[model samples]
Target: MATSVAKCFLLSRCSGIIRSVTLQGKLPPVCIRNRNLLSQCPSFSYGNRASDNPQDGHVNIPVDRLTVSYSRSSGPGGQHVNKVSTKAEVRFHVYTADWIPEDVRQKIILYNKNRINKAGELLVTSEQSRSQQRNMGDCIQKISDIIAKATEKPHEPSAEDIALRASRLEKRNKERLKQKKLHSAVKQTRRVYFD
Candidate 1:
């Protein structure tokens, strides 16, 4: 029975069919259609191991290290907005999160100094949606974007790039010198001999 269920899941995933699958009693029924949506479910089977693949350039935040909370959102949701908490705020300590790469953690801290509190937890909030689940997804996406941007390395100038820059600088200096000489010549003509 277990093998047959596993085969069914693999078939659905390959065929791009959205099916709600629950594993044992651990994970909730999650829509398993694509790899993109897999990250949204914190309890997904590959959620923790997804970050191990460095080739994808994505750093998946594990649920164990995250702190998520919801609060009442101030927006135009009529009576529903006042009664329910839809604003999602996701936070994780930058220094203490062992799942994040050490160098990337420092970069996240440097890039988001304003967002990180004194306790070193980076906070991201989203109140765009009336549904708490949507708001939480948005918050997670924002954090993922910040981490992705932080992971980018500075561009190293190649020999061709350096040569092109040098040529441009030389041309600019020559033009400036020519302009200065022209101005000096104009001022020289403006002078009159006292004799």
Candidate 2:
């Protein structure tokens, strides 16, 4: 069973031709990259983060905190896309959401300045999938991805790391100066001396 799952994962990841793979009526956990196909497999689970800690690296907005509305999707699905309200639009007050960490809220505000409105609400939308449930999930995932990106911090350079970078920079400067001196000598030789 594990091998089958691994094979399915590898096939979907490696081959762009194979968007989804169904094995024995069960879909592997390869729906993350292509979230539009998430509706076809109800059993497949993406990262359903529930914790509030930003340091933990995942943030899941409580259902109550989110205000979701559905509209007709303009994506591929032919007649179904035109008739059904599959597009999901989610909005939440970033400043009022107590579940998110204060620091993370600040970061979200900083990173997503365009997404946030004057009322301090973060708006997210998804029309990638034809299914309403899948589209809603996609909207949530988009928000989570944004929050996760904001949560990441650049690693502080250690003493050795800093010293090594300084030495490499010094070496590059010396090489540049040597090249400059050689070029100046060549230009001097080209000049007609008026001795």
Candidate 1, pairs of clashing residues? none
Task: For each candidate, give its TM-score against the true structure.
Answer: 0.71, 0.67
Candidate 2 is scored at a TM of 0.67
lDDT values of the candidates?
Answer: 0.62, 0.61
The sequence of per-residue lDDT tens digits that candidate 1 reaches over residues 74-186 is 96989999998778777889999776678878889888999999998999998987876556556655776676677678999999999999999999999999999999999
Q: Please report the candidate that would top lDDT against the real structure.
A: 1
Q: Model 2 segments beyond 4 Å from truth?
A: 1-60
- Residue 113, candidate 2: how far off, in angstroms? 2.1
lDDT of 1 at 127: 91
Off by over 4 Å in 1: 1-60
